[model samples]
Target: MDDLFRGKHHVKVDGKGRVSVPPGFRRALEAADPNCGPERNATVYIAHWDGEPFLTCMTVRGMQEMTEQVRAMHPGDPDREALEEFLYENVEELRLDDTHRITMPKHLRDAAGLEGEMIFGGRGDRFRIYSPDVPKPAVSRLAQQMSTRPAGTSPFALLPDRPRPPAPGPRPGE
Candidate 1:
C-alpha cells in the first residue's frame, strides 16, 4: 500500500501562526510532490471552505489530480462551479519550511477559528487541521456515532483485510 496519512496529532500553533507538521505526515507530503527534494520545499494546498469546520490539507500532486477531475465536469454544472470555487478561491498554497512547518495565513486561521493547539487528523490521502473546540455539527454527529458503535468493537474490523489491487495505468492520450 502507498504511504497513507493515518493517526491524529495534536500540534501547537505558534505566535506567528506556524505549525510544525508531524514527521510522518511530512514524509507523505514530500513523496506526493514530484518536484520536492532536499533542494526544494514540499508544497501543500489548504482549503478553508466555510462549509467545513476545519482546514483540509492536500499534497501538491493530490490537488492537481482533484483539479483535473473538477475540470472534467460540465462547465455549467452548479456542482462543478461550487467545487471549482472550493478548489481555487478557497484554497491557499503554502510551502513547508526547512523544518517541515507551514505558516497558516491569518485569513485561513480566522476562517477555521484556529489558535493554540490544533488537531491534525490524517485522512489517508490528505489530512485536516481543526481547532481544539471542533465547533462543527459534524463533530457532534461523529461523536454520537462513536458512542453507538457496539462495545468492544475494533474500528479496523470495518476495513477489508484483503490486499489492494495495483493502480490502473495512465489514460491512453496521456
Candidate 2:
C-alpha cells in the first residue's frame, strides 16, 4: 500500500520512442519486481486494449496478479477466454535502461497516438500513458463532480459498504 503509484508526469517522446520514466514510478516498479536489483533492470508490461487512446503500464507483479485473476475463471468460458486474451495478448514487455527510460515500441506508440508530450497519470499499481491532445477522460468529469459533494465525503463511498460488527450488549444495569 505504501508504494502506490501516485501523481502525474508530463514527458516528451523522442524520435525512437524513448521517454524518461518518472523516478517515483521507477521506484514503485522496482519494489514490485523481485528480480530487479542493481544488476537487473525492471521489466514492465504494457497493455493497450482495443482502441483506447492510452497504454496501460504495470510491473511484472501487477501483470501476474491480472493473469491469476483471469486464470481463476472456468476454462473455455466465453468471458474467461476474453480475459485470457486481454491478459496475454496485445502486451509488450519492456525493460528500463540504466538512464531510467523505456523505449516504447513503434506499434505501441502508434496505437496510443503517443508523441510530443505524454501524460503519465498514475493509477495505483499501474499508470496510463497518452497524448495530451486527446479529450479529457470521463473520470476527469467525475473528479469535477467530487468538488460538489460535502467536504468529508470520500470517493470510497462508491464501493459497497463494509460489514459492521454487532453492537455491544447492554450492561447489567440496563
Candidate 3:
C-alpha cells in the first residue's frame, strides 16, 4: 500500500451527497492502484477525522491487508470479539465512478454532520474527507492520543503480515 497520500483540495458536498474528487487526487489514486480494473470498484473506508466527518478511500487490497493483520492478532477469540466487531462495523466498501467520484452514504454524512464545505485529505493508502467544522475536543483528543502512542503501534497491526525483505548480500566486490 502506498504510504504518501498527503494533499489538500476543496470539495463540495452536493445536494445529492456526491462530492467532486479533485482530478489531481484521482491521479494519485490511479497511480496507487494501477492494476485495478477499468470499472474501478475502489473499496473505500471513510471515517470522520480532524474534527469533521471525512470520507476515506482505499483499494480493497489495502483494506484486506489491514484486516488480515487484525485476525492474526486476535483471531476473533472471545476476548477480542468486541474489537473484531468494531472493525467489521466501521469499514465499508464503496464503488467509485470513472469520474473518480464517490457518493457519500446518508448515514455517514449525518454522523459527521457534514453540510456544505468539505476538505479532502490524502493520508497514504487512504484519504479522508471532512466537514468544515470539526469538534475541538475530538481534534485535541486525537492529537493527544497519537502523540502518546508508542512508535511501533500502527493502526494496521491487525492486518495480515507482510513478508520482510531478505538482508542485502555482501557489498559488491567484497
Please, what are the lDDT tens digits per residue for candidate 1 over residues 7-87? Answer: 889999998999999988888888899989879998989988777788889998899999899999999999999998878
- Candidate 3 regions with alpha-carbon error over 4 angstroms: 1-3, 31-35, 48-57, 74-79, 135-137, 140-174
Ranking by lDDT: 2, 1, 3
TM agreement with the true structure for every prediction? 0.81, 0.81, 0.64
TM-score, candidate number 1:
0.81
Full-model lDDT, candidate 2: 0.85
How does candidate 3 fare on TM-score? 0.64
Q: Which ten residues in a row have the lowest lDDT in candidate 2?
A: 137-146
Per-residue lDDT of 58-164 in model 2, one digit per residue for the tens? Answer: 88898888888888888988999987777778888999999999999999988888877788888999888888886775325447666778887888766778899
For TM-score, the strongest prediction is: 2
Q: Candidate 1: which stretches are off by over 4 Å?
A: 135-137, 140-144, 147-152, 160-174
RMSD of 3: 7.9
Q: Per-model C-alpha lDDT, please?
A: 0.85, 0.85, 0.64
Q: How much RMSD separates candidate 1 from the native structure? A: 8.6
**Clash count (model 2, backbone only):** 0
